[model samples]
Target: MKLARFTEQGRTRIGKIEGDRIVDLSAITGDNHSMRRLLNHYRDWLPALQAATGPMFALSGVTLEAPIADPQKFLGIGMNYRQHAEEARQAGIPIPESQLWFNKQVSCITGPFAGVVKPAVSDKVDYEIELGVVIGQRCRHVKAADAADVIAGYLIVNDVSARDWLQKSPTFTLGKSFDTHGPIGPWLTTADEIADPQDLQMSLYVNGERRQHWRTSDMIHTLYQQIEYLSTVMTLEPGDILATGTPSGIGAPTGRFLQVGDVMRLEIDGLGFIENPVIADCAQEVMP
Candidate 1:
């Protein structure tokens, strides 16, 4: 089932998407209308959510919000796609034998149709289209074979970056965590709905031009391995998002950067798509 968080008539509520309509889960969820809450107790609520008969709203009439707005952790893997790693190698970045991860501060989270700000201090903004994995349960020291059990589902992630700021930090946090940088979710496509996570196709388009296109099958490290690798270090909690890396078509390799007014549409086959417009940073703060 596709679970979503949306606002209609000024109130945000949890819903289950059916065709073009959103069936409200308010009565069933009570005051726990957030995706995080539902995901934490997903096993317990699955039956009720499946049998929901609440009032329905046209999907177009509501504004969809980020499926998980306040996740405990938002992390990303770097250069996990074979061709993308090769491209990074050519750009002077070494390929790691183990997984390379970085943090994208939770404040950067934004809705699917929100605007991505082109910071006034930097003009070298770039985009990386990636498959976002949302964790469903808390676990540690998980095995690759057991990873699927902890997964809630998937979504599209546009890992926006500020090239100049990126070079300043080896961790890639500053460049990756800019406000409005992380655009995820039209909604979450539960694991049961997806036959195979690694076989899906994903792509990105800027201003109507195809900038990146690749399949999840091209990933050098599969999603299961990533989960296993991460859980070995720390507890993987529900609502934690793992951006499973982007493919070879990111703008950074060619000097093609995003500018104000450019719209980035990122799509992952079964998970759905998120299109965000690039807008100028209008904040008056002075950059030293």
Candidate 2:
């Protein structure tokens, strides 16, 4: 089932998507005020939510939002895709010895259809379309074999990056965590909704020109392996997200970085599609 979080009037609410309408689930558990809170009761409410029905509202005209606005952690893997890693190597980045991880600040999170502000400080903005794995329960030291049990579902993630800052700074977090950089969701798709997360086709297009196209089968390390690796370091809490890296065809390698008005469209099979417009920084005021 496709569960979406959106705002109507002035309040944020959760809903179940069916056909071209949204079945309101705001009153579902009576305890989940936000998607972050809903994850705490995801298992218990799954059955009820799937079987529920309410006032059907048109899917359009609602203010859609990131599935979970306030997750405890927003981590991402780097160069996990075979072709992506190859591109990195060709671009002078060393081959990874293990799953490389980076932090994408929660503040960067934005709705899937929102505009991504091209920071005034950088001219080399880039896009990385990745499958976002949303954790369902808190766990540590989980084995890859048991990782599926802890997963809630999947979503799309546009891991936007600022190349100059990324390359100049010693760490990847700052460049990757710019506000509005992490565009996620249309909704969260439960794991049961997906038969196998490892064989899906994913693609990205810029202004209608297809740039990246690959399958989850092309990932060097499986999502379960990434789960096991991440869980061992820190507890994987409900609503925690993992952007499992991106495929090749990034703009920086071709010297074709984004300009102020470019649009990026990303999609993953069984998940959803996201289209984000790029705007100049001056068009978006920086928060003090």
Best by lDDT: 1
Clash count, one per candidate: 0, 0
lDDT agreement of model 2 with the native: 0.89
TM-scores of all predicted structures: 0.97, 0.96
Q: What are the lDDT scores of the predictions, listed in order?
A: 0.92, 0.89
Q: After superposing candidate 1, which stretches have Cα over 4 Å from the reference?
A: 285-288
Every model: Cα RMSD to truth: 2.0, 1.5
Error at 129, model 2, angstroms: 0.4
- Tens digits of lDDT, candidate 2, 11-88: 668888887888888668453557778888877877888788986678786777899899999999989998888888
- Tell me the deviation in Å of residue 12 in model 1: 0.6
TM-score for candidate 2, residues paired by index: 0.96
lDDT of 1: 0.92
Model 2 misplacement above 4 A: 29-32, 283-288
